[model samples]
Target: MNNLLDSFSNFSYRNKNFIFLSFLILPLLWLGIVYLGSLLIFLGHSFFHLDGFTGQIVYEFSFKTLIELFSSPANIDILIRTVALAACVTIGSAIIGFPIAYYMAKFTSPKVKIFLFIAIMLPLWSSYLVRVYSWKLILAKEGIINWFFEKLNLEWLLDTILSTPVIGGPSLSISYIGMFLVFTYIWLPFMILPIQASLERVPNSLINASHDLGANKRQTFYKIILPLALPGIIAGSIFTFSLTLGDYIIPYIIGTSKFFIGQAVYTHQGTAGNIPLAAAFSLVPIVVMVVYIYIAKRMGAFNAL
Candidate 1:
């Protein structure tokens, strides 16, 4: 063992380039075979058609599925609903996470910062299903929100809100607002950590210089702090948006029977057994994310990433 270790060490030192290339090859091979290969297969399946009556997939290439997906009003509506909901979640996560992240990065002591950072990430330790179900319970008709409102004699207010159209429903658990709340809560850590990292990198000297140059707190935030933090915000948005786009579970748990892109894909592939249509539908999010990342890179978010 000793002699083998010595020989391997000598080889590593003698052929550093080969060693590094060897080290990279395994992961690259795994990525190509497992990830990209599967992706290519999935994409290839989209070009095939499924027979509705026979319920069998026809392997021959066709564009009918793609056309149907793009032209269908119901599918278009689902796409729009998902895009809008994801945008809301992204915006909401950014708004709630930024101040907390800013405080952790700029104001807290090292110990306090560590504690806060742990607290921010603590939710992730729990099972995702557990978190989603917890929100389901919390937003149910007889759940804590209703219980609290009852205690405060504000049940009537909630009743009124739930009776209104668009954002309202019979219960908070099945409303758009509830889904938004749950999504923001689930993805908050992703936003906070990135923003905190970006904030920490902004030197105290720059902040002091800004103040010395007659910039007030608000001006410093607007001109210096915000501009520097933009990249992190964009990074966080990418995670929150893409996750929301591809998520069906959260919407299924905390929302009404409305169909999002993920849910639609699941239904088409699993229940309806239309693999081609499902694959075509699934491409929407991937294409959207590609465009989104491209735009983010153009806006200089890649620097922070």
Candidate 2:
């Protein structure tokens, strides 16, 4: 082992480019064969159609599946619903995470910071399904929330909110509001970490400089802090938005029967056995994320990464 290490070090010193290329080859091959190759195959599947009579996938090239993907009203609604929900989740995560992140970055002692960071991350150590189902119990009609409200003689407030339109439904567990809350809770950590990292990168001198220049707290935050932290905010939003867009489980477990893009893709592929439609449905998030990333890049989000 010592001889092998010495030989490798000598070889690396003598032939740096060769070693670099050698290291690059495996990953490049893996990307080509595994990632890009599979992506190409999946995208190709979207152009094919399913035979109505025999229920077999037709291998020939056709645009019928793609056309139907865009033209179908129900599919369009699902797409819109997914984007809307993802946007809401992203905003909510940002709102809830930013303050905690700011405090950790700016005010907390090292020991307190470590403790708070651990607390933020501890929830993620448990199974995602466990956390989700816990929310399920919490949001149920006879669950802790209702019980708390009942003890306070405010059960009518819960009932009233659940009866409201759009976000509300017959029960909290089956409502859009419940799903949004779960999404916000689940993705909040992703938001906080990035924002904290970004804020930490910001020098205290810059903030002090801003204050010295006669900027108020609001002005300093708006003009100095936010602009610098934009990249991290955008990065966190990318995670939250894309994750929410592709999540079927949270909607299914915590919310109503209304279909999301992820649920539609699962149903089409697993239940309906319609591979082409499933592939096409899966493309929505990919396309959306491509555009989203492009926009984020234009806004300088990639600079932080």
Go through the candidates in order and give the C-alpha RMSD of each one to the true structure. 2.2, 2.4
Score candidate 1 by lDDT. 0.91
lDDT of 2 at 172: 85
lDDT of 1 at 103: 98
Best-fitting candidate, scored by TM-score: 1
- Give TM-scores for every candidate, taking all chains together and pairing residue i with residue i: 0.92, 0.91
Runs in model 2 lying further than 4 Å from the true structure: 1-13, 21-31
Model 2: per-residue lDDT, tens digit, 187-294? 889888888888889999999999999999999999999888888899889999999999988987888899999999989999899999999999889999999999
The clash count for each model shown is 0, 0
What's the lDDT for all of these models?
Answer: 0.91, 0.91
Which pairs in model 2 have colliding backbones?
A: none
Q: Which run of 10 residues does model 1 get worst, by summed lDDT?
A: 296-305
Model 2 TM: 0.91
